[model samples]
Target: MIKVESLTKTYGGFTAVDNVSFVAQPGRVTGFLGPNGAGKSTSMRIMVGLTKADRGTVTVGGHDYLDIPNPGRHVGVLLDASAQHAGRTGREVLALSASTMGLPSSRVDEMLDLVSLTESESKRRVKNYSLGMRQRLGIANALMGDPQVLILDEPANGLDPAGIRWMRGLLKGYAERGGTVLLSSHLLHEVQMIADELVMIGRGQIVAQGTPADLLRESGTFFRAVESTQLVEALAAAGIEASPVADGYRTDAEAIEVGKVAAAHQITLIELKLADGGLEDLFLELTAETQRESYQTGGAA
Candidate 1:
């Protein structure tokens, strides 16, 4: 539902985003992941037309954001939680957004309840809201138009554990209902659980992009541990090499197959652990290399 093509953004001599391209499809949460200073925010800004791109294009539902009729109604963006006026109440802020879009004022109350901010507090001003409350209010404003495409950056930043879980479920549900969600976050674990696919960026470029399972499978091998004092010998007998792991030997064999092999020899099966690389491991491995290169270059200079 959303496509970014060769999106480039430069600030004078420095390039913040460089030829970055990706697609966010409906019925799945597509994660936009990168470390700090990797141009995630810059790319997001360009996509929503908040910041003009130096080159390339972005489209939501086949129309550029600026060219779309009622752009706010076509795309809901929550890039900054503190963008609202501090003097306005939560309800008033959302009411203003609705009015700007020519939407009904009832959308304001609906969104407030949707974000679970229906309860009025003594400190009702935007300035007085907690960070988490402000984040929710931002989300409420984004939902005011009930747009098909949702673009959020670090939506769970100030949320507590329960709030984070709630946000995850909400996004997942939205995707399941055929809405397109493009979310950017540094929280790998949460993304792993929430996103169906990921676009991983490093140094303003895409390092990898694929389904979480696909990326994990392609990045490394899964090993199953078979505990035996004769592990090395058994592996050698089976024409397989094994590596020592925390609990037992790790062999590049299917877990069940390895178990069968262990059982055949009566090797006294103890523990069978599967060692598969995760998103965190892959992200660190990929980005660490970039960081190392940058460090080396800086040192030379």
Candidate 2:
């Protein structure tokens, strides 16, 4: 288990993390979500003893990371995938880590196979590797020690669709085998599909933390009908206002409620289902003030 309590960090007058606290439990994949510069990376850096926190405590399992006998053996971290030595082969990189961790050279081969990095690909220099391949090598290196906890920052950044799917399965399987995972990313939709629990942060503070269902449980229902004008009129008559969304109308009312209204008016209901856009809507709503948008390709925020 990974626990963070009242963590705070600042650089000069700028606060990067503020009184933040959350747990990434064993047997679960926890998503650390936020917009860019919302303190996710800073917090993770502090967690792994990379950056000093102004205050509060973070521990993997039970002891401080620095105090652990061999921190990498207990907490696998992949904060920057491109941080590898450009001159070394992928296999050479993993071999170095395995050697430092006192593991046999066979362990390096194990990791390469685990990450599906073919023998020929593993022999190529890191500088020649694509971002996706580098990411794979990074993951293999992180798992080189067979750590109990994993802290990753945007591991899916450069992955293709299939690679993303493979990574999702790998992390989920790791958690299922009783490892703790705390992954940070701003990719909202991707995180929703993989995380068992979510911790959302903005402006250096946590905004929400809970299971997807707990935070997004109230996602409104969607309604559609063949009798366009008549359906809107019927719902309005019943005092259940629905506004246009997608190819249909969405409302706070339950599907049953909307269905009953349509049935009562003899309107041909076409579609009635749960609105699947709740996570995105909630993410936007919570981070509206913290988000920065660039209007044009070269424009500044």
Tell me, by lDDT, which candidate is best: 2
Clashes of each: 0, 0
Model 2, residue pairs in steric clash:
none
Superposition error at 112 for model 1 (Å)? 1.1
Q: What is the C-alpha lDDT profile of model 1 across 1-301, one tens digit per residue?
A: 9999999988989888989999999888999988888889999998888899989999999988888888778788999898889998888888888999999878877887788886584239999988899999998888788789999999999999999998999999989999999999988999999999999998888899999988776653334334455755775688766655433455666567666667777766666644444577668756765554332211223
Evaluated at residue 171, the lDDT of candidate 2 is: 98
lDDT of 2 by residue, 113-163 (tens): 988899999999999999999999999988889999999999998899899
Clashes of 2: 0
- Quote each prediction's TM-score: 0.82, 0.86
